[model samples]
Structure formats: C-alpha cells, structure tokens
Target chain A: MTVTTPRGFRAAGVAAGLKSSGKPDVALVVNDGPSDVAAAVFTTNRCKANPVLWSEQVMADRSARAVVLNSGGANCYTGPAGFQTTHASAELVAQQLGFGAIDVVVCSTGLIGETLDRDALNAGIEAAAAKLSADGGVSAAEAIMTTDTHSKQVVREGRGYTIGGMAKGAGMLAPALATMLVVVTTDAAIDAETADRALRTATRETFDRLDSDGCMSTNDTVLLMCSGASGETPDADEFTSLLTEACHDLAQQLLRDAEGSEHDIEIQVVNAATEDDALVVGRAIARSNLFKTAVYGKDPNWGRILAAVGTTDAVFEPSALDVAFNGVWICRGGEPGEPRDTVDLSGREVTVTVDLKAGRQSATIWTNDLTHAYVHENSAYST
Target chain B: MTVTTPRGFRAAGVAAGLKSSGKPDVALVVNDGPSDVAAAVFTTNRCKANPVLWSEQVMADRSARAVVLNSGGANCYTGPAGFQTTHASAELVAQQLGFGAIDVVVCSTGLIGETLDRDALNAGIEAAAAKLSADGGVSAAEAIMTTDTHSKQVVREGRGYTIGGMAKGAGMLAPALATMLVVVTTDAAIDAETADRALRTATRETFDRLDSDGCMSTNDTVLLMCSGASGETPDADEFTSLLTEACHDLAQQLLRDAEGSEHDIEIQVVNAATEDDALVVGRAIARSNLFKTAVYGKDPNWGRILAAVGTTDAVFEPSALDVAFNGVWICRGGEPGEPRDTVDLSGREVTVTVDLKAGRQSATIWTNDLTHAYVHENSAYST
Candidate 1:
C-alpha cells in the first residue's frame, strides 16, 4: 500500500531540521529500472515555484531516475537564490546516486515566498540517498506531509504487475490541479507516451475533480514512473484502468482528509448538454460558500443549490431542472417537491444530484462543506 | 436621507404577515411625475425570481409609475404560482394608486422555492399605498431588508435636482448584481435613455464591483425612476457623476454591513494592460477565500494574494508583480520586501494594492473578509 510496493523502486525519508517541529521533511525516491519511463504534470498556475521550474526541465525528456522533495519552504517567489537551492539539492542527490543532475526531479511544499536552508537541504538529500531502501515508502510519504493529518498510500494489483502511489494535500485544492504532490510507481512495461496518457487520463477524472477550496496553488506536481521489473507488459488499456483506480482511491483519501472539513459532498450533474457543461455546473456548486455552509448546517437548503446552478452558463431550462439531496428529491421541475425534512444529512457523506435535462452527458465533482473550522484553520494557517 | 427625499415621490411600509416576525415586510413607492421615464437592471443569473420577471416587462416601455417590494419570500423557483403572486401584488398597487397594472414594478426577497400568501401580499400593498407619504422612505427602506442589520439610504443634491435611493442586502453579493433590492428616485428632468446609461455606468463602478461573498442571487433588482419634479435638465455627465457617487456611498454601506463581516477589504489592481484586465485581477483577488480568510486573521499573508493573482489571465510578468497590505509593500518583485509585522490590519478597513506593471489601467473591487461569524451566520440562516 505504498509507492515502494511496486518492484524496482527504493525510497527514503529524513528529518533535515528544515521543519521547526523536528519532523521528517526530506524524501527521496529512485527507480532501479530495466526500462526507465517517466511522465509528470505540474501546476498550470502562471506563478511557478522554484522547484517546479527546475523539475520541469528534468521532465522534458519524459525520463527521470530519482525525485527529491522537501516540506519546509515552498521556495516560491524567493528569486534566483531559491532556484539555486533547488538546483543544488538536485545536484547533491544526483552526485550521491552516481546519476546525472538532469535526470533528478525536485518538489517543495510549505509556506510560499520563503527560502530554504541550503546546507540542511543538501545534507538531507545526501542522507536520503544513502538510506534509500525498497521498504522506505512510508517514511517518504510521511516526509512530504505539510498539514496532512495522515499519510495516504494505495497499491493495486494487475494481471502480472503492480501499481502503487502516495499523495499529500490538505487544502488549496481546486480544478486543473491542487496544492498536492503525488508520486506513483508501476512495474508494468509501459512506454513513455503511454505512461503520460494514462497518468493524464486518470488524474483528469480523479484529482482534477476534487475542489476542496477554490484556491489553486503555485506548487503542484504529479509524477509517474515505470520500472518494468515485473517483466509483464500489460495491455495499455488494463494498465490505465488500474492506474485510474489507484488515483481515485488516493483522491478520496485526500478529500476525506481535507483541512477542517466535516462533510464530503459528491455533486453529480447528470443529463447535461455536454460533459463540459456538467462539469461547469458541478464546479460552480462546489465553489459556492452559501451551499457549502448550508450543508455544514445540515439544513438541506435546496434553494442554495438551484441558485448556484443558475450562476453557470450550462445549457438547461430554469423551469426544467431537478435537484435531490441524498436521493431525496427536494426540488422537482425547479419548484418544491418532496419535503426538505425528509432528506437526512446527519452523516459525513452527502450526495447532491442535479438533473440538467439538457442532454445525455454527465459529470461528478467532490468537495467539502464550509464550516467554522474551515474558516478557523485557514485564517490562522500561515500566521 | 431616503428615496422620498426627492420631490414628486411618496413611499410607505407596512407589516404584511408574510414574515412570521411581523416586521415591516411590504413597501410601496409612487412617482407623481411630470415624466414617467424609468430604467432598471435585474440579476444576471438566468434563474430570475418572479418579481424580477414581472418588473423586467414593466421596464420594457422605459416608463413606470410605482414599485412594490416585499421581504418575506423570494418567490423564486416557486413556478407559475409565484408569478401570479407577483402579478397580483403589482395589480393591487396599481389599483390603489389609480394606474395601469403594467406600469407597476414588483420585487421580493427572502427564502426561495416557497409560495407566498397572495391575499396577505395584496392587503399589504393596499396598506402601503394608503400610508404613502413624502417622509415614509425610511419605512420603505426598512421593509426591503432581509438579514441586513440596518437600513441603507443615500441622498445626493445636484446643481438643481436631487437623487435619493435605498438598498437592502446582507449576503449573496457578487458581480452583475447581488441579492439586493434597490430603489433610486431622481427629480432630474432626463429621458429614459440617459437614465439607463447613467444607471449602468454608476452600478458598473459601484455595486457591480462590490463582491461580498462571490455568490450571485436570483432576486437582485435595481430600479431608477425619474419624476422630473425639479424640472432641471442637468448636464448628462454631471448627473452620471452624482449618480455614481450615490451608488458608491450605498455600495460602501452594503460592504460595511455585509453578513458577519469583520473587515472590509478594497482590492486595487494598478498598471494593468486594460481596465478589464484590472477588473479581472481585482475580482479574482476579491473572490479568493484564502485571501479573505488571511485578512480576517489579520495575518498580512501576501503570498496568498499573489497566488490568487496567478489564477487570472491578466497580462503581467509574475516576477514583476508587487503586493501591499494597508500601506506597506510586503511583496515587491515577487519576493518579500517590507516586514509583514510592520503592516497594521486592526482596523475594519483594509486596502490591498497590486502593481501589475503592464499598463496604466486600474480597477478597484470591494469585498469582506471571511470570518467565523460568516460561517456561523450562513450555516444556520436558512434553518
């Protein structure tokens, strides 16, 4: 149930004194591969982090032998000095592992606009490289966490290969990407193009659909590496399916562990003019503070739901829309239908279904309800 | 000052039994005009309320004699029955004022998807019409409130005329319009075309730029009625300027009285490529929950501001961006500049300035910080 569960992968984590709490903050994962294939996706935010800027060059050839990550400072907007810290850290890892610096990927997460201590980062990377082992995935996961309460990991078995992954994200989650860092490893013999295609497809349906908050981050990266140690060249379709399952599981775990969230909401927009329209409508509802707060109160206020839907440009007649809360149709034909009291909202899991009645396409988005804790956690987070 | 401060206008408010609290829930305003020129704007949300739909038609001919407003129910998504209630209320106001029903406008606010008592609404309209007087504008303003803590009223004296108006909104504020009901009366001798242009211009810079919570509503309406009682044909530009001032005053009042807000934030985007780009950047920062929460905490987290700005497509180099909280530039050249500790945010008013370094165009957006009281208020509001 960890990234190292896949064959030909070794990882390590170390406490580098970068974090004030003396917790582990540096991680390294290396691929001992017969076939070295890699693919990655970075945040689309125009303001790229120093580490992201450095790693984007490493992923240019779609092949990376190692990845080093730290969780003290994001090193974003810290100027040229921050870029040097990232470059030096990667170069130290490459030197320790006897590999070229160009093949090393780097990631950082924490408070933005702060420079990292170069000496501590370099020593941590050297130590991480020396301690890399096949069973070090758990520590690697633990090191990547910033505000996460627990480490998230998943392992899926294919016909003759295995896929494993780890993710860390607590808040600043939105579409396109989130303030998350994910690393997935597979032993399947997949080509670089196929790995890229599968990773994009899986993330688009899973991580890209989770809108914990409407804020995007400047440091988000997801990387996939294939080592082909299982000697099993699984079919591309089957590999994509397993990868998607792994990603979906990790996404759910992230949603459940979102910062200060009480309720996990699944907004399903069905019967839309197009899948894009469904997604647009779902995201609008997910981003509504009013709707999120109502759900937090367990009020079953369907009026807020319709009001959010009305804000979207999705193709749907106002008079023809239908909404349901947890399978109880509270609004039908855009008017009051079943009693709102009939809908139960005491549980942490809630589902809101909207029938657009425009066409046959549909989409689903996951989000968290707004609560006092959410405001509290976010208000004092960086202070 | 209130809507009746202008000559040739009489208004009244009365309890209609529509609100269970038995507060003043109905209001009527009549224009005994030498000219009945009128112009109005409704919520841009596609799912408009019954009153907005009815009033939209009354403004078709660019003329109106009276407007009736209620605060017990939104009459939105209540289907055809809700439309009938709005129509019947307008007719009752017209009958009492001895005018055609088509010349009377209607507006409603409160819970959505619930049917209103038509008989009670009609009786309240009659009572309001009977009690109408030049000094009743305050009562009319009080009647249109939903969750607002106090009534909002403004009066501006022109060279030879006066503009008086009232607005009610506590939450669900966004661009295009908020969940607000506004009635502005002017004794200036202007045609409907000029009135329409001036109103759009005024609202565009004032109310349209006030995004309290980033939630557009279904029952927002702004109406302007010209009585021509002053018989002063003021310069068109001067009238627009005065109108903009009045609207800005009311908008500031609305921002101050926003639901459970502890801080009113002004986001000014300077040196943008265009005014639209400036507005886009300002609105993006205004709608960022992370930025608002940081302000509520008084943390002066300039990184969150930059992260929000990064999400917009406005023309600007990320490395050249600068941000300031209050009067201190904490972030310059995309890096930390002044110490955040030097910035003070203990006051209710806060200003965030962003220099895009793209052009000379700029825009300002007003918003409120997200606070615990905001979550608590909205969570339990509908319940």
Candidate 2:
C-alpha cells in the first residue's frame, strides 16, 4: 500500500536487513510535494522507548520528513545510550536523504533493552534510502512486524485523493493512542492541525477501542503524513472522514492479528449517560479474566458480565441493566432473560452487549477470548 | 471458623445440597456472649455483592449476634430480591436462634448472580442449629471453599484466651476483596472501636497486600466476633497485637493456597516517596501477566519487571531501579546485574525485591504465577 499506489504521493518500502532473520526490517515512506503536512500520536506510557521518545519530541513540530522503523529491537530501558542510538539511527536516514534529523521519526519493535547493532542499522539505513520508491510501501509494511502473523496494509482511493496505511501488532500490545506503529500516508491535502485533530478523534473510536490483552506497551506509535502531490486539497471535513475510514481499516487489521486469538469478541455498550460510562463498562468487561476465559471456552457466561460491570463505578440500577451474548439476551434487568441453550458461541466473532438503559451514550471495544494457545505462547516468552 | 466452637458459642455446617459437588454448603455460628465485641471490613469494589452489602451494614452496629453463610451461590446482581434474600436469611437464622434479626450478619458465595434456595436454606439453618458444637471450625471452613484446594484455618492461644479463624479464597480471588469470607473468633475482650482500628491496620499489612490475580472481588468480607467469655479483657494494645498476629497467619495461608500456583510470589516495593507510590509500583508488577508468566517458568526475566514499573507514574528513575528475583540480583540500575544461573523455582514460594532509590516507604503484594493449569482451570469453567 503506497501513497502513489493510491493517487498522488509516491511511497516506498525496502529490505534493510535490521532483523536477524534477514527479513526486511527497516521501512521508510516519504511524502513528495509542496504541501508536506504531518501529525503523529505516540504511546502515552510514561516510560516510553527510545524511538517513541524521539518521535514525541519531533511530533511537537507538526511536520515530518520521514518515518524510519526497525523491526528487531524495541530500544526500551536501554538508558541514555538507547536514546542516543535512536537519534543516530534517524540521523543515518536523514543525512542519507538530505533531510534534517529532527524531521525524521523513528520506531522499533522486538526484544527490549539489548543494544542495537550500529553498523547493521546504518547499513540498513543506506539500503532503505537507495531502495526508496513509490512502490515500496508494501515492503515497508512487512518490515515493521514482530510477532504479527501477516502484514497489514490497506488503501482506499477517493475523488483525486487517497488514504493508505500499514500497521503491525499482534496485541499483547496496548497503547493509549494506538496499539502499534501505523504510518498512514495521504495525498489528500490537509493542514497538520486537521490531521492531528482527525487522527486523535478517529483513533479513540478505532485503534484505542481495541483492547486485545490490556497490556500497554512502551513503543506504540502512529504517524500520519499528508502530501499535496495530488494538487487537490479537499475540505477538512472530507479529510477527517477519509482519515476515519483508514483508521477503521487499520484497527480491524490489528484485531484480526491479535496473537493466539480465536474469536474476536466485541463488547458494545449502549444507552449509557456518557461515552466515558460506556467505556468504563466496556473496559471493565474487556479486562475481565474470568469473562475472557469463558469466552475462550465458548460459554455464554452472562453472570460474569454482570459481576464485572457491577465492579465499575458507573451508576446504574441493577434492575435496568441487560446483557446479551450473540444477540440473545441471557440476562435482563438482573434476572434470567432468554434460555442459554439458544445462545451460540462456536462463531469466530462474538458480541456481548450491555444496555445501561439509563441514557443515550454508546461505545464499542474489540477484544479476543482467553485461549490455551495464548497461555502457551505468552507463558514461554519473556516480555 | 465459627463462634460456637470457641467456648461461648455454638456452630454447625449442614448440607443444603447447594453445591453441585454435594458438599456441605450451609453454615451458622452463634455467639452466646455475656459481652459483645466485634469489628469487620468490607470490599472496596464500588459495586458490592449482596453479602458485602449485608455484612457492612450489620457490622456497623458494632455487635454480631449470629452469622449465616451459604456456599454454591453468590447472591449478587440478583437485584432487590437478592438484598431481600439476605434479610430473609438473617431473619431465618435470627428467628431460629432467638437472636434479633439486626444482630445477624449474612454471607453467600459460589457462582455470582444465582439466587439462594430459601426453603433449602431454611431447612439447613434448622439442621445447623441442631448440629451446633463447640468444635466445628473445620467443618464450617470446608463448607465455604469455592475453588480452593483446601480449607484454611488457624489457631493461636493467648494468655487466658484464644484467637481462632478460618478463610476461603484461592489467591486468584482478588478481594476488592476477592471472594473472601473470614471469621475470627476470640475470647479476649476489646471494645468495638479498638477492634475496628486494629482490624484495619492488620488488613492493610496482610489482606490488602495480597494481589494474586489482581481481579477484585465484590463479595470479600472479614468479620471478627469476640465472646469476651474468657473473663480476660486485655488492654487495647495487647488485643491489637494478638489480632495482628492471627491476621498474619491467615493471610499467609491464603497466599500459599493461590490456585494453579506453583510459585507463591512475594513482591516488595521499597524506598519510595510515599506508601501509596510503593503500593502502586508493587501492584503494577503484581498484575503484570508477562512477569507472572516468567515467574511460573522460573526464567528470571527481569526486563518484564522494569517494563511494568516504568509504565507507572511513580517517581522512580529507570536507572535507579534494582530488581532481585528469588534473591538473585537480575537487574541493577535498570541494567543487567551479576550473571547467575537460574534459581530453583521448584520451591513453593518465590520472592522478588524491587528497590527504588527514592524514599523510605514500601509495600508488599503476594501473587501467584500464570501457568498452563491456570488457563485450563479458568477456561474450562464458566461462571
């Protein structure tokens, strides 16, 4: 998924050999045109990784010349040395491309704390710069994945404009702004402030709402760059809509790739007094281990749902609450609703709806069920 | 344990056939004390269980004439009727024992949201009254367990008195308190206010520090009922010391009984700016699934510990942190420590020390590891 593959801006992805597997691990996407608009959202974790730290400082400037990502190291908890290594990494790419270091954004994913191979990193930077092309976006997407089973790339074209993005995360990963590193390049001309506003708004409804394992990571980042190469700038409202659609596509891809996930479980909260209440209730159910376990076992356990919701501070009359699993109301008003035998759970996607019946607010959170494979995979691997 | 087993009271554990396993499920304890002395602590979960609601309200009277507990059904989220069931249950026990209804406290645990069988419960009440004995603590203890592998009970003899208690929880039960129901009976005399203060302080060091699974329960309650029958009214200070010791013993037992737990992990966060910061750091590590998984595998993965701590807003510099897993300094100043082979994790308990070069405050949280058996046990059973 390249910017030029969409409509106006050209994109590129290349094999920079940053990973020990000799896989394409370094990716760079450059926006070419007069209007070089950009915005970014980094992880909210206080103890951010080196790449995130660098991107955070640069994101304040509201413009990005390049997005440089490596797949084999997270560069977290490596102390001051890690930050310097990250800075040098960006410098390698920026100097090669004749761009300032500060205009370049950096990202990494893999084992944390270990020092990166400076020579290999610099070599990869040279290769990436030389391999840069509008058609390299797909290769760039493949280079950023760590445990993800597949590459996630999406492109949607509109009237003389385009939105294309690539994301990578198998979701032991959590982020306040986004789950993983997603770079969305657009030929749709938009202001940096508009991109930031639309990205934040779309993210809360998209990436942020997907709560795979509830374990927030230190290196999650999402960068959006806009180039006016299309020579056609749309209204801010249209750009926001296009951004939302792109975010929705990437969000779906992240959920689909959640590690060891079998069923994609969604908890939809409706009729709450506020979106915060819906989120509180949704998050309460999303983080519930018992509830997740039941879903993994393919059991319509509505009791745990009620119990989890009751644990939250959201005010609601127990008698007015209702819960449904797979469209069948298993519990209503704190009493038995439909029979359990009628509810099916063998599907790949399950929906658990909790109606507050208190007001008119709603939200949705995507998650996965607890499974034996999840335990087997995660228990053996150290964080 | 029951009050009647301690010299001035009668107790009974009878079969209402409430548990699917056909284990004795209904228990009653009565206090025929010449002096009433009592105190209690309820769950911190805002959406409390039915028993929590009843117990908190009754213990506020500073006197408990009787307590009726039924397993196999946690009368929670049963709405107004669930509240009414507790009232009716207490009324039944109170009527049978000729004790005032307000003097009776009620507790129920098992599956959440299930209604109690009032008729069966009433019959068990009569049977328990008939079978009341002065040494029925073990039977009562066994009847209260849900998934606990064994009943936890402890006894300590004091000067001219004794402190005996029983608890039911399998560590995964986070007492928000996790499904905890504790009953401590003593013959020493202490006023209600003194007992409450001592109980709170003791819990803060003991029950409140156990975070095994970090999933807060809505039905946790701890009740202390003193008969004052020994005619040995100790001073406030002496009474508090004995209570504290007894609490320590019981709390340790629960930690050891954590379900599917091969290693009982004790995480101590020390040298902090405040006790609250210590607790925050302790809990962040305690709740980390990756850290717990490493503990289960005996891998001494210290990076997970650093990753977890750094996620918190607590004022601990990454370079100023040191971590010891089972006495092996795996990380110092947020970097690799002395190289050492793996520790023998076959032992029943594991200890982790996270030293923050900050202040003098610290906290300890007891937890179990994430094992394959845990996933199997939880996933196989639906609530």
Model 1 TM-score on a 0 to 1 scale: 0.98
**Model 1: which docking level applies?**
medium
Question: What lDDT is reached at residue B183 by model 1?
Answer: 92
Task: Put down candidate 1 lDDT per residue, B1-383, tens digits, no spaces.
Answer: 99999899999999999999999999999999988999898899888889998999999999999999999888998999999989988888888888899999999988888898899998898889889999999999999888888999999999999999999997443211247888999999999899999999999999899888888889988999999999999999999999999999998888888766889999999999999999999998888888888889998988888888889999999999999998799999999899889999999999999999999999999999999888887888778
DockQ of all candidate complexes: 0.64, 0.50
| Candidate 2 ranges beyond 4 A from true positions | A2-18, A173-179, B1-6, B173-178, B340-346
- Give the whole-model CA lDDT for all candidates, comma-separated: 0.89, 0.78
- In model 2, state the lDDT of residue A313: 77
Residues A46-151, candidate 2, lDDT per residue (tens digit)?
Answer: 6677888888887888898788888777777677777898999888877987878888899888766577766777787788788887677778888887778888
B199-224 per-residue lDDT for model 2 (tens digits): 88888888888887767777888888
CA deviation > 4 Å runs, candidate 1? A171-178, B171-178
Give all TM-scores, in the order shown: 0.98, 0.95
A1-383, model 1: which lDDT tens digit per residue? 79999999999999999999999999999999987899998887888889999999999999999999988878888988999999988889889988899999999988887778999999899889889999999999999988788898999999999999999997443211236999999999899999999999999999889888888888889999999999999888889999999999999999998767779999999999999999999999999898988889998888788888999999999999899999999999999999999999999999999999999999999999998887777788777
